[model samples]
Structure formats: structure tokens, C-alpha cells
Target chain A: MADEDATDEPQGPRTTTAEIVPLRLPPVADEEPEPLEDPRTGDVDEWGRSERVRALVRKAYDPMYRNWFRAEWDGLDKIPTEGGALLVANHAGAIPSDAPTIMHGVETELERPVYGLADHFFKSAPVVGTLWSRTGGVVAHPDNAYRLLHDQNQLVLVFPEGSKGPGKTYNERYRLRRFGRGGFVEIAMRAGVPIIPIAVVGAEESMPILFKVPSVARALGAPYFPVTANMALGPLGALIHFPAKFKLRVLDPVTFPDVEPDQPRYSRSRIMDESEAIRQQIQEALFDMLRQRRSVWFG
Target chain B: MGRRVLVTGLSTFWGGRVAQALEADPDVDVIIGLDTREPTVKLERTEYVRSDENYSILSRIVKATGVDTIAHTFLVVDSTTMSSRAMHEINVIGTMNLFAAASAAGSTVRKVVVKSAALVYGSSPKDPYWFRETDRRVAPARTRVERSLLEVESYVRDFARDNPHVVLSLLRFCNVVGPDITTPLTRALRLPLVPKVAGYDPRFQLVHEDDVVAALLFAIDREVPGIYNVAGDGQIPWSEVMTIAGKRGIPMPPFGIGLATDPLQRLGLVDFAPEVIDLLKYGRGIDNRAFKDAGFAYEHTSAGAVEAFVQAMRLRDTVGSDEVDYRYEEDVETFFRHSPAVVRDTPPS
Candidate 1:
């Protein structure tokens, strides 16, 4: 409306569409000005998840996931392409390589990162904790998970069976342990995210535990010192894997009622039932996969 | 109404600077500085009072000056000049005397801000990477000074609870580095051979002297209850700190440090406090979200803090000549140009 004051204009309202041009600027001193610090630095966030570190970790372990474990998977589409979700899987083996395998498979398949919530033990162990955090591992806590899911909208990977699954004896392999009074279910319910049950088959067999030494475990401040038949061979010999092919089955996502983190609509007993039902699904899937599999060394 | 502020420990740089800065503020009605020794720095409005560890004298000063705010920075960090026994008495007992005086002052002394170190958290294998205020502090009797500071904090806490009307804030600061603030870490990392723990390279989240003063001034202005961690952002490894200070690290074994620390302190080469070993082995830091929530922004980052100390060392190297000091300015610029979390501060042309 103020353009009428501009006498230089040819006309008030008559004009052809003006051609849009890309922004052009005069050449300046130091074009492409470098950042003050290295771009590779400060990649880690407050939660200690570093995309750069995660990328590097994935690069180092991709071969192991593919060739070493022969990890194969299905139903990644069950996870929402957007928004947060919980990937509740079974934990197994003395050294839990299952976290990495499941994380790698889901990350590569979904083309999105899934943060693994590690125990406080991993958060306290000097170099290990720092490295763990950099590699997209958050210290497992209700507040952390709540923030990751509700506030940050991140897909999180959790092993509800916890240390109980891995600390099991050789005979207890593939049997899903109690899911720690069902905290993961409550987390899922509170965060308002669907729970995708993940059943990993090859982990328990990959590093099979022949037996364990509880006294040694207690001395080392570990849950149990698993003395596998392969481990008895020696340090480097223990590293030699049996090449048990990992077949991952991701069941359909189970939705829960939306609630605030501190809201008490969901009781302890109901959450436990839901957790048990989810655990049963993964356990049954493991049995079915075992029925289909012809050999332990091969898929 | 204007703020009547009293600054304790005028002998210390932190106390003197805070006194002077508060004196400069037009909103401040009066500034009263108290210390055992005379202040090295000149002040404008602050009245310097030479006072001993007498509760009655401190209480009289508070009431006479009508001081509502007390900034306590006299927590003896460097005790090379004084005997260890004297330093303990001055730090612990003096603090108790001040608290007693302030308690006697009652609502007249509305606020008391105490300067505590991050060392209260202690360096341990079990410590969280970023310590929160709720995390358990170190048990008593870790080091002589640390134990004293711990006791002092408990006393302050008790005082705060007892006096509901009074506002008490405890600042847990990490290692502070700048031209003015001279700590043992800065002296060790000065030049040539930087003494360090053999196998450990702890990460230090250093705060700039400017940031420390700013935080103090901010607390003086606001009423933020409870304890808050104060430090500039980002952490630099101790090895990197030595490297940035232009020194080659001399890794000392634990036993060697234990043996030589006494002689080193005696020679005044460095203030080798007892807690230095644990600090060198395992670092201490805290998550400073509380400060952020209180609406304060830091001017310098951790990298800048270390860089400022290094620049000061360079300045000290060429103390007599302004031309030589100017030559060292570019080195600081170049050093900060590549440092993470450093802000580029260009002078107004």
C-alpha cells in the first residue's frame, strides 16, 4: 500500500511475474570460513549419545554382525518410521553381545538409530562407561528413558530380562527370565510408545556357557563369571565363535494406554501381567525358531 | 532499597574483586570488606576492616555496616604462606565464627553465599560422570582442607535450616584458572615440565576467573536457594591442559609424588595439597543445570579458562616489555582459534 510513494515504479498494479533468482553475494575474505573448533568434536549430547561415535562403532562391528554372527532379521516395518517406540528383547550369553546385534540390525534396517539403555554398572565402570555413552548407550534409569522417549522422541532398545537372562546356567538357555517386576512395561505405558517384542536366537549359542563360577563373579563384582567350554580353551581361543546364525523375529508392536510418567492409572500387577505376556511372545518365538532350525552352527 | 553487601576474606583475590565489583554497583548501598590482613587491591566504597577470628567483632561489623549480603570467599585453598594448622583454624573455625555472627545478625544478613569446591564430591571410580547436587558428597576427613570445607558446609546447611528467613547458596566450583586466580594446578601446568600422575589423565572442567566472579555477582543479585555447581562448559583432559599450556608432561609415579610433594611445597615450586593425588588420578566435576535454570549465561568456556591461564603465563614470561606481551597475544588467539567451546572475542575496532 505504501508503494504509491515510489515514483520510480513504472506502474502501480501492472507487471509480469518476476523471475526468482538464487542469492548471489560478493566474494568475501576467507570464503567457506572454518569453524572455531573441529567439527568432529562436541558430537556427544547431554545423554552421551554421539552420532560420530555410533557411526564409527557401526563401521567396526558391521562385519562381526554380518559374518561373525551371521545376523538376519525381519519385520523392521513393525516399528513406526516416526515417533518413539520401545524394543524389548531377551538378553542372553555371559558377555551380552546380543545388545549390539539387535541394535545394529534395527539401526541398519530402519535407517535410524536406537539408543541402548545400559545398566548403571556400565555407567560407573571408568573407560567402559564413557565409551558406552559415546556409542549411543544411555545409563538405564526411569528418568533417562522418560526423557529419551517422551521429550527427545528417540527409539530405545531395552532388555527387560536384564542380567537375569544372561546370568542363567547353560541348561536355562532360550528360557526367558522374569522381566524385573515389569518396569519396562510401565516405561512403555508412561512414555506412550508401543512395545516391539524382539527374540534373538543365536546369542545364547554363539558364546555358549558350559558352567559358571559364582565365587569368582562375586570377587570381580560381576553377576557371574561364565566359564564356557570355548573360554576354557584360553583368552584368544575363547574369542573363536561357533558361527551360530542369529535369526531375529520382531513381533507386531503392542500399544498401551497413554499416561504421564508419574501418573498412577496403571498398577503394578497389571504392568507385570503385560510384561509376562510380552515375554511369553518372545519365548514362544524362540521355541518356534528352534523347531524350524536344523543345526546350531548353521541357521 | 539498595543492597548492603559485606565481603569476607579481602586478603584473597576473589574477595577483593567481589568487594570492588559490588562497590562499583550503584544499587549497592555500602560494601564492607573484612580480613585478617590488608587488601592488596584498592577499593572505592568498601570499608576494609582488619578483624581476627572473633565472633563478636564480626557480628559488630555486620550490624554496624548494616550489611544484608555476605560473600564468603576466605575458604583457604592456598596455604603455602600460612602454617597448615593456622589455615585449618582460619578456614574451619573462622567460617563457624562468621556463621555464628551472621546467625546473631538474624534477618539483617538476609543472604550468605559460600564458595565450596567441586572436590567435595571427591574423585572416585563409583562417581557419576556428571554429578548432580543430590549425589552423596565425600565422607569427612578426606584431606585436611577438604574435611574442613565439608564441616563448614554442614554448618552452613544447619544455619540455613535454622534461619528460615535467610537465603543461603553454596557454589561448588571446579578448578578456576585465569591471570588472577593462582591454584596449584595452574602452577604445575605453567611451563617446561608439567608434573602429572603417571597412568591417569583426568578430564578437568575448569571455570574461568571471570565466570567465577560473574557467578558470585549473579548470586548476590538473585535469591537462588540450595547448592549449585559452577563451571564453564566442556572438559579438557589433563594431558591436553599441559599441552595447551606449552609444557611437556613429566609423569610422576604415585610414590614419587608422595615423597616429593613435601619438598615441593617446602620449596614453593607448587602447592602440593594432599588431595592433589586423588584429583590427578580421578577427576571431579558436576552438572551445572541449576545455574542455567537460575538464568545466567557464562562468557568464557572451559577451553577459554585454560587458554586465559596460558596467556597469563606468557605475559608473566615477558613481564617488562609491552611489545613482547603484544607478540604473545597472537599465540593466545591461535590457541583459542582451535579450542572447543571457546568464543571468539574480537576487540572493538
Candidate 2:
């Protein structure tokens, strides 16, 4: 009786019965006989940049960038709308959450992908290692930076302070560390790209470290192990953080023409001069933002 | 009277194909295929000579034919498949004999072309991204095949000095893959599962068997003055290669691999040597720009070569181990017979 009723009810085309269509991926390039070029496809680029993993990470961190922090980015226009560029900034906090934010900020605004170069230690960590590479974080080295800026025409972000800035305690917050030996200037000069200084405020308050345990740091093979106020409260302490509003200010970009840094005319003083100029610009931006802010917690 | 050419080791696959390639060419020439054993493939229009390179045998052939070009394709890297004595005689002594004959014949032998392996670079953590011909050929002292090839290269280099009239050329091939290839590497990749170093993902450069023949033919037609490292440029990490080969890669620690593969090796299930394990960790890469500058183009990259091998594997339920059986430490029958009796009703005879 049920079969006869079903047959009697369905007099129309069988298309209506299709609740879910079988997913079909179109054959790669029509199955034609054209040869395949060595293309950077799927998840990763030739330099190990992964779009899929970057997208997944962006989705996971959207809440932090959008709601809890309420981050506001200013001077987006200072970043070139096209071509290669470098965004040099001061890094802070145990976890460099600002790195990803700055990266996503510029990339999303320009509708282009940006690369972040971090310390080699990050690549040795378990889960963060994979996440770092997939989200376009390269192991910080001259060759890696050269390849990104020059060969790939990428917007690479570098923290000249190395690991010192991010591991700073709350007492030393907002104090700029020494930029290492003007490497970024040489890179920008060679790549023929401009360097845009970025000043990120309230990043130091994200994960305030009261003290560090050397023994724990040694055991975990980490550079420094921080005992934050929240971490001191115990395991559940990490579940919540004191929300600090983030204000990002981009300084004017400075550029040097594409020239070899080794020439006798392009002495070490000239490169250092370029580096110091950019450093001063970032320091001014930080002080300006600090003065304008009424409260650190409210931005 | 014409530009006579003689190809040694006609019994081998590379030798057979090279001879066939020369036989079809319209360039004024005569083709002579010389070997002791019968060829593995049919040699059309190639005059086969059944003789060893012993004493006066090869010298007489070189003299009587007045063969100006000699293509030596007998270099072997996988030594596990053959008897130790046979391998040394063919790879070491046979080369000495051929060079002696050519050296004695002097200017009559116009050219000596060797098909060599790029294993001379040796897999190392310190190796460059791509090895140029000018880079040092630094193989470990214990690596016998590579050490022996170095010996042959020295001889070839000396022969070039002694017999300067002969245009000597060397082609060092990277890993080779194709449908007709039956080497230890290809056979290992054909396995259902392969082991990789847990954290080490080394890049691989595989030249197709056809590209190897094509380069050999170019050496035959023109006099390439120096050594050339021949490999397709489609370099990628082994993990990606495993993805392409459709094989499940089990990541094992470098030392832990011994515990897993030792029993398999002892049982003759897996033929990967210790050096091969290192290859999986720090694979080899060779620069083929010199060949490109010489007006030769490769039709298959490393990826294309691997894809062809995978396609051939899909066509057959399983790849046969007939020609590749010699690549192990023990005989097939001995391996099956020693297999704990419970697993074997009848050992393969």
C-alpha cells in the first residue's frame, strides 16, 4: 500500500526528490593534454605559505580581533595599495598575537596576503610550528626575508628586536629595544620596497608576565617561561584574560632605491641612518598614540 | 668505413634502448651491440656480438669494426641484486677492459660515453640545494658503488688525457623512474606502505627512463666535452612524492626505523639498505642546466616520471619482481625457505 501511494504521488520529474546533490570536483583543467607548469597550488606556496590554513586560523581568531579586543587600525593608507613592502614593528607580550593582527589588518585592507617572519624557536614548538608555517610565518633569516620581499613581491613583517621585545615584563612595556644591525634596511634596499613602521598599543597588557621560571623554561626548551597573573591562578587561569583595547597606528613609509649595500659609496653609516630614521618614526607614533589615549584598558 | 658505433652491455635495459635509438638514426653509421649475455629486449637491426670483454675479445671487436664511438651503459648502483663477484667484474673490471681496448686502439676509438649515477654527491644534511658539476664529489668511504664509480671516473678522465682524441662524456643520472624501470627504488616505492623519517622531509629529483635515453642519444650525436648531471627539475619533498605515489608513508624515527625494517630486511620483505634510509631523509638533487645549455629539452619532470610509474602500477594488480629480485642480500628461494615453516607450505622454487 505504501509503495503504490508513493508511486501515485510522484508524477513529476525525479529532480524534486534530490535533497542533496553529490559533490563533484571538476576535473583539473578539463583532462586536456596541456602540460602542467610547476604551480604553487593547493594549501601552500613554493615558500611554504598556506592559504587554506591561514583562512582556518583567521576564522578561529576572528572573535579576538573583532569582539573582545575591539581593535582599530589607523593609517591603512600608509601601506602601499600594491607591489612589495615591509612592515616593521615593535613586538611584545609572551604570545605575539599582535603579529597576526597586523598581518591580517594590512592583508584584509589591501585584499592581499602578507607574510610574517618570526624567530626560529616558534617553528620547534608542537602545534604552533605547523600553525606558524601554514599562516605564512617563515623562519626569520636573511635568505627567507630576501625570498619573500624580492622574489615573491610580498609584504613581509619583521620585528628587529628579535625575541627580546615579546618576552619583556610589564615594567619595560612601550620601551623600544635596539633594532638589530639594520638588516631590514638592507633587505628593503635590495628588494626596492618601502618600509612602513607600525606601532601597536595595549599589546603589552594582553599577557602580562609577573615573573619567569628558568627551570620550566629549560625543561620545555623554550627561551623564557612566563608566570602571568592569570597563569599564577592555576590551570583555569588561562581561560580568561584582562581585555585590553588595541590601537594600531601606521607610520609613514620610508624607501631606499634598489642598490647593493656592499658598495663603497653605500657605507654602513648610510644603512644605519636609514634604520635609525624608521626607528624614530615608530617611537614617535607610539608616544603620540599613548598621549591621545585616555585609558589603557579602554583605549 | 662509416661512423661506426658500438654499445656495450646490450643485455641491460639502458644499453638495449640506446642501441635501438642509434639503429633507427639516418646519420651515416653502423650499430654494434656487444655483450656476453643475451639482451633483455629484442634488438632490431642491431648486430649482436656474443663475446666477453676478456683478453683479446673486446680489443679484436674494437679493431675489426674500427668502431669510433663506444657507449658504455654498464654502470650499476644497486649491488644487492647481483653476486658480489659478478657486480665488481661488470662494473669494475669490465670498464677497465673496455677502456684498455679503447686505449690500445688509441685515436681509432673517437669517443667514450659513460652512463653514470649522480650518487657521487652522496646524501648529506650539508649538501647544497642543487649540485653543480663543479661541486666536490664527496661520497663516504664506505659507499662501495659510489666509490667504485669515482674510480671509473678517474679512469675515464685519465683515458681522456691519454687518448685525447676520444671525446669522453659522463652523464650522472639522479633517481630514474618509468614504466619499464625495474630498480630497487622503484620497487620499494611500489610497496603498499613505505617508511619515512619522522621529521625529515628531503626533496627528490627523478629523471624519467626516457629522458635518460634521450640524453644518452644526444651524447652519441654530438661530442659533449665535460661531465653533465642529468635530472628533471620537478623537485619536491618525499612526503609530497608519497602523496603522488598513492602510498601511505609511515613516519618513523631515524633509529626506530631499524627495529621496524630490520626484520623485514632479514625476511627479504623490504630491500631498503641503510643508505637508502638516509636517502629518504636527505634525498639527492642535481643541476641539469648544463644539459639545457647544450640544446636538449627533457619531456618528463620528476613528478611526471613518478606519475607514469604510479599509472603503470594501477594497471597491474601488483608489479612483478622478476628483474628486481637480484637487488636483495639473499636469494628468493632461500628467503622463503627460512621463513619459520608455518608461513610457507611450498617455498617458491
**Estimated TM-score per prediction?**
0.77, 0.65
Q: Write the per-residue lDDT of candidate 1 for residues B1-349, one digit (tens) a residue.
A: 4567888887687997787677556556678878877777755446667788433388788767667788998887654546768877777888888888888833378788998888778775445556777777533456777776778888888999998777788898888898766787777776468877775556567888877887887677667768999987766666667767777888777445767777877887666777777677556657776786766566567777788777887887888334321111334543565667676554222
TM-score of chain A of each: 0.83, 0.81
Ten consecutive residues with minimal summed lDDT in candidate 2 chain A?
Answer: A16-25
i-RMSD of all predictions: 17.4, 23.7
Give lDDT tens digits, candidate 2, residues A1-299: 87434422312212211121111111112233345344212445444456777777778777878787778989889988777788899887777668978877776678788888877666544345545756887667665576567766788999988778877788888888888888888878867778899999877888777778889988887878887766766797754555678899888888665565334244579789888888888888898899999987788
On TM-score, the leading prediction is 1
Candidate 1 lDDT, tens digit per residue, A125-162? 55665677667777676656776787668899999877
- The 0-to-1 C-alpha lDDT of every candidate, in the order given, reads 0.73, 0.72
Q: Please report how far candidate 2 places residue A19 from its true position, in Å.
A: 58
Write candidate 2's Cα lDDT for B1-349 as tens digits.
2347888888788888887777555442578878777666644456678776432377888888777789999777775566446666777787888889898833367778898888778876445546778777444645567677777777778888887656788899998888787876787787777777766555678888888887887776665768999998657667667777888877776555757877997788767665577677656678787876765567677777788777777766565543533232223434553557537433112
Runs in model 1 deviating more than 4 A are A1-53, A79-86, A111-114, A119-134, A141-156, A181-196, A252-256, A262-278, B53-56, B76-88, B105-107, B125-128, B135-147, B191-204, B234-285, B314-349
* Best candidate (score: lDDT): 1
Look at candidate 1 and give me any clashing residue pairs.
none
